[model samples]
Target: MSVRPLTEDQRDAMQEITNIAMGQAGSLLATLLGVFVNLSVPRINVLALSDVADAIGSMVGRNIEITAVRQSFHGYLRGEAIVIYGRDGCKELGDLMGYDEVLDRTDEIELLLDVSNILVGACLGGIIDQIKGITEAHGAGELSFSAPSLMAENVPAEVLINPDKLTWTHALLMEVNFTLEGRNFISHLCMLMPGGSIEKMRNILDEFVASF
Candidate 1:
């Protein structure tokens, strides 16, 4: 499916919305880890599934072992939200969460899911809340989502890029990076909205901007 690229104005508005959501997510992480979370400016882009890896590498660097968890959301818009952690970062997270000295594979997986649930839920909830606020303020319908489940983890980027895994040919990708101050931990949160929902989001963003 062909979709128009987002205008600068639209991108700015979306960036602001994503910034708000990322702030909420950062706060939640700070509370969970008992450390300050430094967030980079959110980035918005439209790209095909094949191009996602390059974008991620640009943010997280190259030749890193990445672990990601994905959760799908639906309502007025539908998409998948991914929380990615580098292998070393995952170990740091495990330590911060107070895991045992030697963690088995199962233990590591559990920790990853636990953290993923917290981060994904907080981020997606914040986004939905903002969207709902806009719609309610403008007298539009509410947006909602289902409970997030662990879709994949510790999977290679190449494995993840299989055509069968990506339901949409293209998506609007929003990325936000988080770093734990005084620690070696870094994480990237990415949200992908399909072309169909991108149009819906664009219309809603237009209405949102006009209201202000």
Candidate 2:
């Protein structure tokens, strides 16, 4: 049997679910960071893998540190989950941490790592646990990064720029943003699979949403 492409209704439905997930994440961030977290409208983008590089570059800007945290979940959906934070976003997070001394360049970077780790971990942890029905199953994994220069040496993920030539083979790419202090930030992104495993995740979420 062939899996059908997501209809507009299906896409909207998924977006709503993502909104709920991000709302929970926002609440967690507010509590953890001791400042209010504001979420913008949930924007959904489906793109080619190659175009992702350019899309990231345009959104995050060039000459910025990009830190990423990844976690893999099984049962409902099986794919690499990633949360990326830009350099400015990290700096704002450091200030929120209430460091006494002015953050030097090194201190800024280190504080950003800590902020990235906690915020990304909490955001993803909440969403995955709610979707999977097992709070304990969602565990944290080590985060890694590729230098911005390496992106050119590696694959170009600029999907939005060249939508026509790009293929949408992936199931879904959900992105949400968070603005803290004066900086614009993309808080969390989830790439969900459309394979057999998707049924498990969809069914569970469907029931959860229907109940409300």
- How many backbone clashes does every candidate have? 0, 9
Per-residue lDDT for 64-161 in model 1, tens only?
66777777787667888877887787679888888768677677767777777777778877777767766676565654555545555655544444
Cα deviation of 61 in candidate 2 (Å)?
Answer: 4.9
Error of 2 at 119 (Å): 3.9
Give lDDT tens digits, candidate 2, residues 1-212.
23444555545666776677777777777786787778766655544444445555565455655655444444435544555665455556666777666778666656544554554455555555455543234442322322211111112223212335434343445666666645455444444343453444455545556556
Candidate number of the best lDDT:
1
Candidate 2 lowest-lDDT run of ten: 146-155
The TM-score, computed over Cα atoms with residue i paired to residue i, of candidate 2 is 0.61
On TM-score, the leading prediction is 1
RMSD of 1: 2.4
RMSD in Å for all candidates: 2.4, 6.7
Task: Quote each prediction's TM-score.
Answer: 0.88, 0.61
Residue 41 lDDT (model 1): 96
